[model samples]
Target chain A: MDLGSINPILLVASIMVSATPILLAAIGEMVVEKSGVLNLGVEGMMITGAVVGFAVAVNTGSPVLGFAAAALASAVLSLSFGVLTQVFLSNQVATGLGLTLVGLGLSALIGKPYEGMKSPTLPKLDIPLLGDLPVLGRMLFSHDIMVYLSLALVAAVWAFLKFTRAGLILRAVGESHDAAHALGYKVVRIRLMAIFFGGACAGLGGAYLSLVRVPQWTEGMTAGAGWIALAIVVFASWRAGRVLIGAYLFGGVTVLQLNLQAAGARVPVELLSTSPYLITILVLVLISARGIHGAPACLGRPFHASS
Target chain B: MIRLEKRPQPSQLWTVLTPVLAVLLTMLVGGIMFAFLGTDPLEAIRTIFWDPLFNPQFAGFTRPQLLVKAGPLILIAIGLSIGFRAGIWNIGAEGQYIMGAICGAGAGLAFYPADSVLIFPLMILCGALGGFAWAMIPALLKVRFGTNEILVSLMLVYVAENLLASVASNLLRNPEGMGFPGSRNFKQWPAAHNAELISGTGMHWGVAFAFIAVILAYVLMSRHIQGFNIRLTGEAPRAARFAGVNPARIVILCLGISGALAGMAGLFEVTGPAGQISIDFNSGYGFTAIIVAFLGRLHPVGILLAGLLMALTYIGGELAQLMLGVPGAAIQLFQGMLLFFLLATDVFTNFRLSLGRKEPA
Candidate 1:
């Protein structure tokens, strides 16, 4: 009930850090969906990245290498998903669910040795003058490399989808794979590449969690952040710019709730823990009528050239 | 280059064969995973696939647990299969299950120290209504705003879990007992206890309901007009509209029925095997039932058999974990493999693979 107790400066800083992961994942998934592929295995991919990132960071003592390894590992896992959904002509829904289960189990199994292992912290990039700015510095310029990278990735994707010929082809394939195929675009190839990029971004998000957010390895660590990312894509209406807003909004909710809990506010723990999700759902319900109009026409539908 | 040619009709042979093939492949692949972990591959596989049912040392004890385990699985999967057939995916059955337990158990606990026979039935009704109401949120949203049910349902699971933890730790914590994070043990209460109908056979009220559900589903799917609408809607949405099937009505009906059934399953589970509302009561039956629905090809009879098979793995997987030192996560991986392989092999049901095919330009 009391908003007075919350520190806006620290709150904004925390939101930036927390939003980075969801932003990375959502932005990645946005590209994949733009290419006309829907992969529900974002949660699984993120968790794999989390564990691999944590394990590698703990072993090699470098968060950068850990992030790289996490991305590579999840890309491999997502490749299996791409193969099953694309090459084998399986139902995308069922295949994506299976991928999540596999990712969770595989991450848990792989991380068994690294249980309770501390992750090497990701270093924050501090611009000499920008980082010293009065109010904006702490909120924007003072974050780990991943936060800036996440913003950069969003801008890059926005530019790619808007200005580049490849982006046009990706959007075309998403609009109608048949037409794209008729236009001599390798629909499956474009989709697979998008899927790979999506996987790598999701991995980066997971790595950010393990290396920077919590700075440790824990089972089930991602804790539905990947799902929030999925919802954000829809909330963003598949636009790269809106995706940033959606992630930040969600991240703000999460941090605000935690701050409420920490400030000894009388709000029950259950409501606080689940408020972010409930708020996201509420937002989804509000905008849903207008939301899905921008979704890729062939988003969840599998492509088959022979058909 | 390889190509997939659509068959005029789905192959009947592969429908029944895919689950079996998937199981065999899981064993083969899972065994390799176990070997990499340095366990004896054959022993691990045998332990997971064979020992619990056929091994004399474990069968007497594990056999009775199969129904106990499969009862809720079958109940939930039957509901899921119904919705899935109508192409309305209610992925958050887990949340429904937890809510059902809370409402049913909460109602019973309110009447503690009373011995009325009507209490149990009333609790059952409350349980069903609780789940139905929870599920209706997503159903109505989809019908009204065109929101995706899958994401909404899935998000509700985390909400439900938090609610569960809160209830156990604060709201429903046993007052008489020394500050514990669970409700009063319903199994020990005479009026609310879900006692087994046939002693030593695992024929509790839940198991009986599961059997009745299977029979009811079979009849409805085979003889009912509503069932036809559901099947038609799933297979051909446009054709169903032409045939006078109402999509919104179907969505409500399917979600309501599935939610009610899942609620009953949770109610029965809390009262019987689980004994009370605890912080970590849910064991992923809601999620696992999805695999069962798919593994059974979304058929009633197939779901019944698939439920039993999945239950066998649950019991056997624990046995493998205890005896062979196979990690718990491996069993989950194996279950996931079942769904993946099932979907992979199911491609053959609707299409034929051809080699070096060139399309006529």
Candidate 2:
């Protein structure tokens, strides 16, 4: 096989695009989990956002509105999860799975008519001088607005968690919910807000898929992206910057597998298709070696106001 | 001010009543969903919950199928309940099930066209081993590195599906057939087939195994030191450690046993009703077993009954598909409502739900 058959530069560029949704979703989930709540409904919220985003964009011919609608829909769904698990003190695992089922069903119903509809095209933002640079330009500067936004979000989240009062309060709640409750913080309210933000982020990620990547609505289209994002949260040790890195790494693996198949690699198509999942597991196993640093201490624990 | 008052001991009444309460709540919510779907809510509810077991036109077929469907679910759920009791969530039973089917089918096909008695036993062993080995990945990782087993196990499912496809399309493709992506029909293989032990009733070796699992699980949970340790670790980890229960060993053992049982269920299905391994060999039994485990209250007898109830929904869902043209997703939502309500109503287990009086400011 010719070495020239594959362009390394294009490979890197495409991998970044592929990783954008995961990065966005993971970053959002990182913040949510950091705020003393484990919202396992990312998959459900993402899919809902995907179809809602697609339908709105297709109807209004505005990608911005599509993204906004996706975030809003996902945020609303996330709020349901937050209210149930936080206020009613339902088991998070069961509620999360239910959310996924409901999301899949709801998306199918809403997306029924838009089954074959195409999405509005997102405008590409090419850096004037940087995009024209020989090799690095294709590797980094040339991408849709979402790619940059994902990276920017990572930085923003990193700063917020590291420096801000709100971030500190969120972390305090996550670390010791009882202590935070004793200290007079509105633990449930903060968590609900965090869950909403996480849902909105996941929605944006889902919208990116239907509105930009695939640019079409299909039933179950967000296909395990939510789960992958969850894994990324773990892989990143619940750190925002690490989540960005993990998302990109996963994205690279996905792109690499597809590219390998396209380039007629010796591996079977199914093996190539399964590579992304296998890689995610392997990466997670490796990251586990570093220990669960930055993991919120109080995740998944139901907060009862009284002892 | 109102507070969540602690009972001297958790109420046993709430324990038994939770599932019933959950079912009622699901019926109410699910009935509204059916109404939204434009079907007669009452008729839809009856079709889903009542008609499958009693309607003469359907009961004959559905009744026997219940045992067949419940067999794997009960077997898998029994294994998962062990892990759940030890506070380990083995969410990747689906992947383990697939691996077991693949490994078991692979073993049976390795001795293809042979009419020997050892083939079925060998298949069962390989299936369990395959599932166990696949499960060990997360268990070992969790023990060694303290990784989150939930994500690791669940993610492996996609990997296992790809492996199934690879094997079916290539290595396991029947030579006699013209390039079909599946193994030689297990039913046609006299020794490998898990044929019905009771004729026309659909009762097979798997159902027998499920019953045996329930008895063994009941004994283990009630009369064994390991069972006590598991319960202690789940309910009070610090106390369990102080009492000399090794947490690491428990995690590995719990995950290992669950994975093996899940794998066996997969193996049995592939050889018996499913007939062979195909790309779509899995029917999401692994995922559904979680619901069964919880619905059964993580008790062996409870799981047996819960498995049957869940199996009823599968049969009824199929009937709904045929009779009402309702999409399969609606059925998924219907089943999902059970768990949603189950978790929601579990609140009453620890807290009373009486309305609190508002004091004037």
Candidate 3:
């Protein structure tokens, strides 16, 4: 039994890549939840984005345009959710679930034609000095633009939540919508914006998968990545930095398991592959020990004017 | 005359009728969807809802499969309904189901070729305990740390899948079989086999247990003090607290029951219909059960019927896949449509759909 079989370098790099989608989606959902709405439709939104992004990229031959189209499509889909839950005051749990179902069906419908069609490859934007650096280059710099974007988005989101007035207001609403409402802030409008932002982010995450990761559209391709993103948000405890940590950790576990399987480890390939999910649950159990940090007070509750 | 009013309180009539109305509305919307997809709407509806049960051409084979399919669904849904009623969402039943099957199968296969009577009962216990233990993680987090059970439990499903895959390939691999990524055949092993009681009927003890679960659940929910406590917590938390109903206790109980039942369903499935453990052993039954629980309005009988109806679509949808050139995804989307449309139209049950005069904007 060669215990030293795990290649730590390539292992970490693959983990980062694997973690990218979950990170992107979790960050997006974090913003959404921070703005005082719980969208369980992340998986739906992500999958919808996955197929649509793949389709648009394949047709237009621009990965950038494909990502944009994906975000716009998902954002549009999420707008319907906003109208139903935010405007109509329906049950958030049920409506969000409904949105997922609808998104899934809609994606399947659209993706039928695009199935098996390879997406235009996203080029790795190598950083000059950084990407050229020996071992770390492959581990960090030599990756597609979406990978960098996910990292930047995390930083940008962190700063926005901490310093910006709009972020403050969003936080206020999440903490207590009634307080935000009394302070002359429009809760519904703020929430709607947040919902769209989250949806777009989730869409981008999905697009990253189809456009970059898997490079093809398949039915149910997101494969619960969206749900994992949702969990990462909770695991992150609603903080941007922690979200990065959680996502990467989950990704590392997933990639390591896959690598181990590829290395021809004596262990069953299935068990090794599933290690990430198990590790995610274990991490969630641990992170949940402290309760989630910065969780919005009014999260998952539909804010009614009369109530 | 006791007239139905939009009561200041929640309407009981609406509670009883919403699931039925949701089904009808789903049919209507699904019919439109079928038409949009270039299939005859009425025929699609018939195939989805009717053919599996009544059509002489298909019912012979399809009828028994309905119970086989519905058994796990009803089991999983019933467990989910309990947590839902308590506002403790366990969306990771799929993970729990996978774990149950893995653990149960693993336990049974541990004694391979040694035909002891203890194998079947031990598997059942392992299956239930496996699910119960898996469910306990989320429940414990929610109770002890104020963690979001929805997220924790859901993420765990993926973890459970990974475990199932690993076990199937490594520890549980059949020695004689040529490099297959699956466990030893439990059906052939009499002590572990969950075979049909009445031949060709497809009815197994699991189906019997599901019925028993419905009765047991109905009694617990309607007759017992704990049931009242669960309803109270779901309906009016403040009132429940005032009534001395322990919130933490209810969470534990609800999650435990749900997890155990989900596990039992998984155990039965692996032992009977599924035949062996593999990477694709779990069929999203836990997630679908969430839809089933809601579709059934969280009532036991409603869940039973809803389970059966959902099963019909599974069989019919498979038929459509074989007969028409319709992709498997289209059928999945068709199933998902039931939940989406049901939820969308459920708005009517709560809020009256009436055209309003324009407000002075």
Best by TM-score: 1
Cand. 2 TM to true fold = 0.95
Score residue A263 of candidate 1 by CA lDDT: 83
The deviation in Å at residue B107 for candidate 3 is 3.5
Per-residue accuracy of model 3 over A138-223 as CA lDDT, tens digit each: 88889888888899999999999999999999999999999899899999999999999999999999998888888788888887
Candidate 2 per-residue lDDT, tens place, A75-162, comes to 9988878878987788787678778777877788778889887778788887899999999988999888989988988999999989
Q: Judging by lDDT, tell me the better candidate of 1 and 3.
A: 1
Model 2 off-target regions past 4 Å? A126-139, B1-6, B354-361
Lowest-scoring 10 consecutive residues by lDDT in candidate 1 chain B? B352-361
Q: After superposition, how far is residue B150 of candidate 1 from its true place, in Å?
A: 0.7
CA shift at B226, candidate 3, in angstroms?
Answer: 1.1
lDDT of 1 at B122: 87
Question: Residue-pair clashes per candidate, as listed?
Answer: 0, 0, 7
What would the per-residue lDDT of candidate 1 be over residues A1-307, giving only the tens digit for each residue?
Answer: 6778787898999999989999999999999999888899999999999999988888899889999999998888888888888888788888888888888888888888888777779777878999999999987888888888899999999999999998999999999999999999998888889889999999999999988998777888998999899999999999999999999999999998899888878889899999987987898898897646698999889888866
- Residue range with the least summed lDDT across 10 consecutive positions in model 1 chain A: A286-295
Local error of candidate 1 at A298, Å?
A: 1.1
User: What does DockQ come to for candidate 2?
Assistant: 0.64
Output the worst ten-in-a-row residue range by lDDT, candidate 2 chain B: B352-361
Q: Which pairs, if any, clash in model 1?
A: none
